[model samples]
Target: MIHIYLCEDNNRQLTRWKSVVEKYLLMNSTESQLYCTANSPDELLEIRKKSTVTGLYFLDIDLQSEKNGIELAQEIRKYDPRGYIVFVTTHSEMAVLTFQYKVEAMDFIVKDEIETLPDRICACIKNAEVKYKTQLDSSSRLLSVKVDKTSLILDQDDIVAITTCEDYHKIMIHTKHGVRQMSGSLKELIAVLNPAFCQCSRSAIVNMKHVVKYSREEALLTMDNKETYSVSIRMLGKIQRALKQL
Candidate 1:
């Protein structure tokens, strides 16, 4: 299920957005639900921590927090890079920083324009519903990996992990298809990988989608196929943050 998250500190503005979003979802018959309306970034993050699902975020720029909406989007990306993020702000001057953040923001709406605010918000949600549907229909994304000697193409979604083999100056690409030793480094391999692939260590990178179990006791990550990888204690923090929560 798709969830909508709204974070606005102002109670009156929050109520207005909530009403519009509720109406939009009902009118379009979108199964998506407005999960929570938050007055702070922490509140929204807490709600997401409890549920693992596709999400659309509409955040106000100035939350009066040290970390603003842009930073909130960055934090959300740690767990869900594919989640749609739209910034809602009263100040238009802050709009220029959206591109600088590289959060793949869908749209920026200025709240001062009360007349057009609902229309803009409705449009972004409608477009997001279409985009999320297309992603669901495809299920998996594909990528081509090129090496000096051979070219290999595979489903990026099937990848379990990519690790550096220092001996051969190559990368051991592990996928559901099986392991393939390709001439590449984690640095080079990561450049082509999708956001689902996260660097757990200087040597290892794992596809968060394939991590079925993570053991803090053993500092190990168990894959869907039951293959286990020892996660470095230092990188464990980042690995946990990037991994999808149940």
Candidate 2:
């Protein structure tokens, strides 16, 4: 069950969006509840209050608040990283900042297309639904890895490598999405990882699927992301065997 949240300061626009979203949900038989409609980000956040309900958010960039939609999404990530954030804004220029901050924004719908705005909104919501359901379908294939205080459900296929971070009890996870810092026993992490994953070095394990090139001379394993990790001398034989299977 997905909970949809909307934050738009303009009364007319907010009403229109609410109508459009409701229509989309009804037309597609999507199992989502319209959770919140707030004129202020504070109201929305206050209502959410530590609830980690998975869902989607349609936010207006110009919120006329201390924090705009993007900033609110950042704050929301602190509590609910699983939710999808789709920005509805008049400004097209701020799109770059979204990726730079690693918000992982699903889509952006410009408010300029007044007539087709509702249709565009529907498309974005549909896209979010497809992506969300795809993730849910692979939920059984995901490993729930804890990064600091945040718990991330990661698809093993997206994982590239896991390496000790030099900090005590910390591991750095390299994924197709990006690097994540987590705390765990290397033994614990390796034990939970898939068969394609194996330790290459005393401090690192590379996913065979992500290993693009393996250098025996340099004892280096290059991942699909181009990040290179050293192979321990003892694990060289195991690494070679794994590389041959790939």
Instruction: Assess each prediction's global lDDT (C-alpha) against the native.
Output: 0.82, 0.81
Residue pairs with clashing backbones, model 2: none
- lDDT of prediction 2: 0.81
Tens-digit lDDT string for candidate 1 (150-193) = 44445566679988886767888786646777776788778867
Which parts of model 1 are misplaced by more than 4 Å?
140-246
Worst 10 contiguous positions by lDDT, candidate 2: 146-155
